[model samples]
Target chain A: MKIIADKPKLLTETPMHYCPGCTHGIVHRLIAEVLEELGKADNAIGIAPVGCAVYAYRYFNCDMIEAAHGRAPAISSAVRRVVNPDNLIFCYQGDGDCASIGMAETVHACMRGENITVIFINNGIYGMTGGQMAPTTMPGVKATTCIYGRDPKKYGNPVHLSEMLATLTGPAYIERVACYDVPHVKKAKAALKKAFEIQMQKKGLSFIEVLASCPTNFHMTPIEAMDFVKTQAEPFYPLGVFKDITKEEANS
Target chain B: MAKGKVEFREAYCKGCSLCVNACPMKILQISKRTNAKGYEVAECVDMDKCIGCASCATMCPDSVITVYRD
Candidate 1:
């Protein structure tokens, strides 16, 4: 009980408005844990996107900027260049904000080797926009936009963000993780912390995409949602650190 | 210490019985009452003997268990 209160320096005393069992809360906790671990809460600046985490400005205790739909990378770039170089910059976005609307900005930001960490939440459904299908929406998965399930013919196949981004010549690190359960959630925490560490090393841009759950829109109870994500979604998305500047540094 | 109480939020549980059999105390039984989602769940009668091992929470496919330790 005591440990919970003193947990993270990156979050505020205000409670989250996200629905119960929504991975937004877990994902927020992971970022806070990273801030506390790195002792950068004082100098850290976070950008909140226009999705479910748009309310993140209230939850995260660090200096936060609410960006337009999918424009977090652009905002982060401005902050990283104009603001203190020693300051840690971070951006939080969902699939719609990152993979779809912000793809152009995100890709360009990474190619420029922007020194920042991007926390991407891939729930496959547009949570804030009423569960519309997203670029990462799995094939055959039903969404509000795709009443008959996503089809590669019309909608095309799901975009694999990490794999695609890893092909880029810039980003210092790129990883994808899950927030569905304890083990996977812990792995996500470690991955987020590593992204910050990558940034600290001036290793250029780092990205971490977390597979989150939209229980209300997914039409699943909490546990059922967990099961669906673990068994069905994990096989499709997978999880791993695709690139590591430190590992590359050790070799090259 | 007597028995501890196990509270299950049926809405949060996914009907996975990993907790029902995980209790080594053998004091747990499945509840006949179905939730709004129509999942047959577990109910603990002899909570007095519960050692608070949290085996149910660990084995619980759903993280809906709140164990009160005595």
Candidate 2:
């Protein structure tokens, strides 16, 4: 007998609070798998934000702290300074928390090259807050606040956080991936693994932006939401490594 | 023939049917019965056709599906 696939030990048995078809569970499992594979579960500390993934502290089996709204980056920065160098510290934040309210904390952390990992879930809308418009919301996408579809004239353009963060020289690794389908899911997992590996190597900040699905908020079925991520979000956001100083370091 | 089985954690299943769509062998379907959480859960309708590719399990966001191979 062989176990083909089993739940990662780092994920608590608790049922996730995400609505049906929400891809947050996939990202959580990938992170949990990486934490277990890299032997970081024992010492890893995850900073959870106050959005859709606010209950992450209860889901991830490792030491987790619930940070104030969008303050995960700041909190993780402090944790990185005080904790032992070998311990892994990562912040799991939603687009609402990381890109909107906590934009300053996020930018400063990357600008200073903080030695921490950041898992950013960009589902476009502010999921936990009744699907309001977020900084990462795509153009023409309607949410509770943007009932008439987001108009660039008034709201401005969606902020491409990963690309913006890559512009700074502080981060050692930054990649954008999505959980739309099987192949994309695998790629997202691989990117997450690389992020964790960079952290273990004492490299600078490693940020991964995962374009997740908010089916309930999007008023679409789970399958339809996944399709939207592939067809709509991928074109606007694009996927691939934005920066990898570690690779350059190896070459240099 | 390969032997494999999948167990669904009924309590955790949201019955989104992503797993059903992911099944390559078309062995999965939403059960008419509902779990304690009141959401329908996916069930293996034709166990004999299961290849145990674990595609259903992989696509499951809830991590409710577990695969075993023998």
Candidate 3:
């Protein structure tokens, strides 16, 4: 019988250690699927930051670089500029590392129009290192930092990065996709492939902010976290192409 | 007629009752039987009325459900 669900060639054979219900595995598979489809797995370089997905370097089959916490964007920029200008570089980061601590770096990267594909995983709460409040945490959602609830007065409202980053002309493409369900997941994978293509074309910065789930941090079972992502988080981070600077892409 | 097979992975289910309330077709109901983790499972008895809206799978928390249509 054919192995329908074997690990993707873009990913190592190592088993992922994410929580049983976490969507990180699914998101990783989506990126790997894109890489495999494009045959760019051999040429691609991935930058992983110091958050829950810190050890992402181990899972991705391609050449990988581990960056300092909240520094993947800068590191990716450096990688693209110094080593190989023509190479495809992608930075895989979580909300804590991207939206919170590395906010300045990401904003500057987008503003600079760096030719890098940023696969941002926004699950609201920090997953790997403990359930901490992230900048993308939805209003009224509780995290370890916000025990009572994310008081908007103190924490402020969630920042929609796909929309916020798209505001800059530097980014060539910006879109939001989630793995809450199969159809959304399929769309998410397609957007991811397109984001990678955006970088391959050397058009400019391409950002795919995926709203993921953290059941362990969300204090819900994996299933419930999936529900929360679909029902709660999606409203704040509506999916679709938020920006496409290239005329052909914009028209397409 | 297009028949969609909805597969629910009970292992990741948290039983939040959102799918139960959100399903407009009323095809799914909380089962009296519990799964390995002791959570009430979501079940669909009469899938004939399913419009293939995919709202339940979309609204599920664990990313457990995969719907295949034929």
Candidate 4:
């Protein structure tokens, strides 16, 4: 028998601590597979954010650093300058860490065209903090802080981080993808591969915003949370490549 | 004979059922059996019906399933 599919070697034997059914696991697997396929598994450095994936350092087999809350991009920037040019640097961050507190760092990284990859998990709520409403929380999404659902009038509108960053001239690639099903999962993996490839080519920053699900915090079954991402989240944060310098150059 | 076989790393499975839903052949189901974590693990009810598609493995967030084919 031939093995058609198995776990990526880049992922450690250590079981991930992400909550059951959380989409973070899928993202982690995708990143591992991408790194392995790119032949950069040994040369990859990951920056773990202060969120549900704070323990991410345990799962990835390569070098990993735990960055302070909303400081993953800042740390990634420093790592990029010191690491070998062939080495791949990536930051894994959550909406709370990337869109809220790390907003300035993330935007500046893009503006500076830092040659690194940022995997942003936008789960709409702060999963590690008991489902507090996040900066990317959609209107009418209930959270601990917004028990009655977020009110745009009082809380302001959800921030579209990818779109905002795409407007900058620094970033080389920016895309929004989701993994609610098999097809989307495949697309997400493809996007990750492209992002890493861009980084390896010494292109500018590549930011991928993944619309993930927080089933445990959402008070829904895993399947139900997947449906929520497909039905509710997708509509608000449409999926597609927001920016690609290669495409622009070709068009020009 | 079945065209494909699937294996489960039960220890790593979180029993989210995403793989069951992703199976195009509809042969996967959440079993009454639970892992050490007490989560109901997914099992292939009819291996004969598997088409060697890795959809289940792709959709599985925990990477619990491995697919093999002759």
Candidate 5:
């Protein structure tokens, strides 16, 4: 039999620390596949964030740095400037890190249009910290902090980070995708590959916000959590390309 | 009549059932057998039903499933 699908060589044999059915693993696999396919797996540097994927450095079979909480963007920017120009740099961050604590870093990185890729996972609740309410937590969603369900008046509305970042002129591409199913997973992989390609072309930042699920924290089965991401989360944070300079150029 | 075969790295399987749900052919199921981690593992009940779509592998968060086509 011929192999139709197999694990990418860029991923270490270490089992991921993410909970069962966590979409983070899928995203990690996609990044590894993209890097390997682009022939940059050997020359890539990844910045692991301070969230549930804090040990991400151990998973990707490449040089990795553990960035302080919400500081991955800052670290990535600095690394991008000093690393070999051919080296591919990317940062993996969660909603709590990217949209809440590191909001400034994320915004400035986009505003500067750093030639790097940022994979943002927006799972609504803060998974690493026991499902606390995050900046991206949808209104009325129940979390540890907002156990009674998030009140828009008290917690304010969820942050539309991708849309906000897309407004910046520095970024070359910005898109939001989900991986609750096969078709969406394929699209997310395509978007991730495009992000890496854009960075290789010396284009500005390419930010991809992926809607993920937290089965353990959400107190739901893996499949149910995925359905929640599809029926509940997707409606609030619609999936599509928020900005794409190449598309704009093609249109113009 | 099997067009494809699926193999599971049982050690890495979390038995999340994502592959079971993603299998369009409905041939995947969570087996009672537990892995070293004590989580149940997924198995293909009927290889003949597999169409080599690789949907199960694509949805498997742990990347435990590998697909091959005849």
Candidate 6:
């Protein structure tokens, strides 16, 4: 008589608009589950960014704000500033939003050590815009713009956002987890839950980057996209906790 | 009697087949019938064989699958 896999109460009943096989919905569910588990669903404030997940405001049951592209970090920081200090505030952003257009805001927020959680979805393409090359796109990945495959010498290399942000002293937690497999999906949920926990502790800047699959953009079957995420993406964007200041604080 | 069960919100399934591939029991498959959303949805062929591993639910990006144990 136990409920095993019901939808999280924090997730709205609204059906998602993400493409089939897109991993954004899984991430959304993970975050919603975390919010419900922490008993912060009602107190949670989510900032939705412009990209594939722009409609996220309609999906999460908590109060949400639609922030300008790449400005999600800035708006989230401001929300964290004016809102009840103990309330949970987070940003849901894509690679193009967080690493490309919002790169400065993202980096600055981490530098300032803003006590906010950033759920970054790195699918390595401009998914909503028909699969263009993104800042996080792999060096040799083919996209609409990079039909010939990404060129390191011409277009530069993929930006390791988690690794870059981890170098800053401001972030209390940073982790990169993928959603292509069961074990990794479970790990992703754990990472997201830990990020929220860090925010609750008033630990500054918790960033979790999820390497998601884009089957439509990748022009591959859902299963093949999962394989691509494992074989190609993981080699470039290795998974694991990049930083956890709570551990450092405990050890010290 | 079925030992386990799984239900798919057909309207939400994008017919991605992730669940069909993830099901270790090999009891799930894409249905020929499309849902209200016009995408083929996943369907379990044999509820009796389900182990309740929930792998289909875990790999479903749409969160359309829900599993239950009896």
With a 3 Å backbone cut-off (N, CA, C), the pairs that clash in candidate 1 are: B2-B48, B3-B47, B3-B48, B3-B49
Cα lDDT tens digits for candidate 3, A1-63: 122233467877565556565677778877887888898888889999888788889889889
**Can you give the lDDT of residue A59 in candidate 4?**
91
Candidate 2 lDDT by residue in tens digits, A1-252: 588888899999898999998999999998998888888889999999989899999999999999999899999989998999999999999998999899999999999999899999999998887989999989999999889999999998999999999999899999999988888888988998899899888888999999999999999999999999989999999998999997788899
Q: Among all windows of ten consecutive residues in candidate 2 chain A, which has the lowest summed lDDT?
A: A1-10
Q: Report the lDDT of model 5 for residue A201.
A: 94
Off by over 4 Å in 2: none
Clash pairs, candidate 5, are none
Of candidate 6 chain B, the 10-residue stretch with the lowest lDDT total is: B61-70
Q: By the TM-score metric, which is better: model 4 or model 6?
A: 4
Pairs that collide in candidate 4 are: none
True-structure lDDT of candidate 3: 0.79
Tens digits of lDDT, candidate 6, A155-218? 9988999999989999999999999888888999999999999899897889999998898899
Candidate 5, B11-70: lDDT as tens digits: 999999999999999999999999988999999999888888899999998889889998
TM-scores for all candidates? Answer: 0.80, 0.98, 0.78, 0.98, 0.99, 0.97
Cα misplacement distance, residue B49 of candidate 2 (Å): 1.6
In Å, residue A220's CA in model 5 sits off its true spot by: 0.5
**Candidate 5: clashing residue pairs, number:** 0
Cα lDDT of model 4 by residue, A127-162, tens digit: 998989999999999999999999999999999999
Chain A TM-score for candidate 6 is: 0.98
The candidate that achieves the highest DockQ relative to the unseen native structure: 5
Higher-scoring candidate on lDDT, 1 or 3: 1
DockQ, candidate 2, vs. native dimer: 0.80
Model 2 lDDT, residue A73, Cα: 90
- List ranges where model 3 is wrong by over 4 Å: A1-5, A248-252, B1-70
DockQ of each: 0.10, 0.80, 0.09, 0.82, 0.89, 0.71
Top lDDT model: 5
